[model samples]
Target: AQSVTQLDSHVSVSEGTPVLLRCNYSSSYSPSLFWYVQHPNKGLQLLLKYTSAATLVKGINGFEAEFKKSETSFHLTKPSAHMSDAAEYFCVVSGSAGQFYFGTGTSLTVIP
Candidate 1:
C-alpha cells in the first residue's frame, strides 16, 4: 500500500519570499513521486517528478523537489514566491503497477 501526505492543507507566502510545501510518503516498494499544480478552473500541470534518477529534480516555473529516502519525504520548494504561484498543489505516489495515490492537496496563497 502507498500513502501520501501533504503536511499543510493550506500555506500562505509573501511574494519574493521562499516557499516550502512539505510532503511525506510511504510505500512498500520504491515508488515514483510527482508534484502537480492546479490553477483556478484549470487542469493539473506537472510540477516536478522523481523516478529514482536523481535526489533533486527541477520543474517548470522555478519549482523543485528533492527526494529523500531516509526521511521518506519529497518536499517541494522555490527560491521565491510569485503571485502567479498561488494554486493548489498535489502530491502523488505511483506504484510500478501504474496505481496512483493522491494526497489531500495543498492550497497555496501568494500575497503581494
Candidate 2:
C-alpha cells in the first residue's frame, strides 16, 4: 500500500519569510516521491523527486526537502518565500509503472 497525507491543506506565509509544507506517507515498497507546483490556470510542474536516491533533494525556485524513512515524512522547505511561490502543491506518490496519486493539495498564500 502507498499513500500520502499533507498535514495542511493550506499554508500562508509572508513574501520574505520561509515556507514549510508537511507531508507523511506510507508505502509497502520503496516509494517514489514527488512535489509538483501548480499555478492558477496552469499545469503542474515537477519540483523534485526521490526515487530511492538522495535523501535530501534540492528543487527549483529555492525549494528543498528531505526524505525521512523512519519518520515516514517528506517535508518541503524554502529559505524565503516569494510571491511566485504562491501556488497549489501536490505531494505525489508513484510506484511501478506510471501510476500517480496526488495529495489533497496545499494552497500557498504569499502575503506582501
Candidate 3:
C-alpha cells in the first residue's frame, strides 16, 4: 500500500523568514511526488513535482522540494515567506498503478 504522511499539521512563520514543510511516504516502487497548495475555498494548484528526473525540484513562489529516495521523503522549502504564502499544502504521491495518495495537509500561517 502507498501512503503519504505530512509530519506537520500546521507551520507558522513570520513574513520574510524561511519555511519548511516536512513530508514522508511509503511506496512499493519509485513514485511520482507532488506538492500542491490550496487557498481558502479555492482549487488546488501544483507547486512542484518529482518525476524521477531530478532530486531537487523547483516550483513557483520560490518553493522547492528535494526527493530523498533512501529516506522516502519529499520536504518542501521556501527561502522566504510572504503574507500571501499562507495556504494549505498537500503532499501527494502516485504509484505505478495509477493510484494517488494525498496527505492530511499542512496549513501555513504567515505572521506579519
Cα lDDT tens digits, model 3, 10-111, are 999999999999999999888899999999999999999997878999999999999999999999999999999999999999978787899999999999
Instruction: Name the runs in model 2 displaced over 4 angstroms.
Output: none
How many angstroms is residue 100 displaced in model 2 relative to the true structure, after the best TM-score fit?
Answer: 1.1
In TM-score terms, candidate 2 sits at 0.95
lDDT (Cα) of model 2: 0.92
CA displacement after TM-score superposition, residue 25 of candidate 2 (Å): 0.8
Error of 2 at 26 (Å): 1.0
The true-structure Cα RMSD of candidate 3 reads 0.7
RMSD of each: 0.7, 1.0, 0.7
Question: Which scores better on TM-score, 2 or 3?
Answer: 3
Best by lDDT: 3
Off by over 4 Å in 3: none
lDDT of 1: 0.96
What RMSD value applies to candidate 2?
Answer: 1.0
